[model samples]
Target: MTDHETNETAAEVKVDRQRPETPSYEEVLFYERKPAGFWVRFWAYLIDLLVVTALTSILVKPVFALVGLETSGVPWYAPYAILSALIFYGYFVLMTKFFRQTVGKMIMGIRVVSLKTDDLSWMTLLFREWIGRFISVTIWPLYWIVGFTPLKQGVHDYIADTTVVHEESFRKNKLLQKKTPDGSGLHETSAF
Candidate 1:
């Protein structure tokens, strides 16, 4: 071999030895295949709808009252439906982005995750929770296809390259399970 090629190979070996190897998220989730099935995801969505409905009613009342819409003095052009839509989108996007699961999903022990990664990203959450959902809602059958999919992913999930998984099942997977610094099985959440 040429002298330059020999030196480059030796340098690569030295770099590999000096650098500490960290596992990629894909590697961690490889053995974790327990995606949330139809019933569980459906129940979680139902619970989330109830929660959002309650919260929207409570929040909308004050805003509507301020704009005189609650008591029937509002302008004809007032966008009440748009406001509601925004609230719904915000609730799902923000909650899933920060907590990995909405209140309903938490109750059902399910969480949204990227198909190829361990942590969820903001863009992925937006597409998954908003754009994908909008399409699913407009085309209802697309959402129902989750029941027959191997990974239990609906059209929305496929669009976002995401999947909903049973959080407990994921944590229980021996290959993916990780212990806290304190030896607890639970993941650490920041206190803020």
Candidate 2:
């Protein structure tokens, strides 16, 4: 080999293109596969609609009249759309940020969680709330599709990379666990 070629080979760095030994990307998907039942999710969504409607009625609905904003007052929309968007966006921000539960999800014992990580962030919640409305509202079939989606996601869930999972009942868990302080089998551990 030429001296220059030998020198070039010696200077070159050998690199192994291998990923780090950690969880796979799929394993870390936020939505997960724990699908919520149809009826369960449906009722929870209804609860959310009622709450949002009530809140929007109080806030956005009044704003139009107060500001003397009318359907003909503007060029584009009937003003109701603006009100709807205000309620839609505002309701989501409040529910996910403050309570971490919309009325429907709370009642049904299901929750929205981030798809990328275990923690639920405001951004994820916002995406889910806004996008979810599109799928959750349109019709029953669409809503069912979300529940049946492989990842347990509705439209918003898919868009936001989020998931809805059933919350384990605390009361049931407490009842089932009659344990000892040292962590032994139930029979020996049962103080109750």
Candidate 3:
């Protein structure tokens, strides 16, 4: 082959390699990813609160005791309270950042996903877990908005452009089938 021909063939092959395989009409399926409801999320958050309380009692209480710090009757801005707040925010931030779910969320079979990006970023985590959570915690009723929203998103979710969804809810089932030339069934599957 001529050099020009060979280069053209190589370019064609590269373009083909970059192109995605388009599924035929027979392979198309419709399925919706169910957003976590308020009750489930409430339970998950309750579990996380229990975990945070336990962690604070086990980890923070000891340090305060050892340092002769009085935790009782102290103001909210006290050193112990500040450390506890740090732990609270840190737990949510780190867990969501690393696993996309906290221990409670894992138990509840729910996970946080970003609507805007494929992967969660630090800024997203900070906004969702820290600042957003602080607001939710303060207002308390803002968490209830999850149930009312079309996508079942909480205030924090709205702020960070994230949503909680049931884990691995998508499954390949025979939602629709087509007959092949040999009378075999062609199954349709759902995609996330």
Best by TM-score: 3
TM-score comparison, 1 vs 2, better candidate:
1
Cα-lDDT of candidate 3: 0.88
**After aligning candidate 3 to the native by TM-score, how far in Å is the CA of 151 from where it should be?**
1.1
**Could you tell me which residue pairs clash in candidate 1?**
none
Provide C-alpha RMSD values for all models, in order.
13.5, 16.3, 13.8
Candidate 3's TM-score: 0.73
Location of the lowest summed lDDT over 10 successive residues in candidate 1: 22-31
Ranking under lDDT, best-scoring first? 3, 1, 2
Off by over 4 Å in 2: 1-34, 63-76, 135-140, 169-192
- The alpha-carbon lDDT assigned to residue 132 of candidate 3 equals 89
Q: Tell me the whole-model lDDT of each prediction, alpha carbons only.
A: 0.79, 0.64, 0.88
User: Best candidate per lDDT, number?
Assistant: 3
Query: Can you give the lDDT of residue 73 in candidate 1?
Result: 46
* Candidate 1 lDDT score relative to the true structure: 0.79
If both were scored by TM-score, which would come out higher, candidate 2 or candidate 3? Answer: 3
Q: Residue by residue across 71-144, what tens digits does model 2's lDDT show? A: 33454356677767677778766776676667788777777667689777777776676666656666646666
Cα-lDDT of candidate 2: 0.64
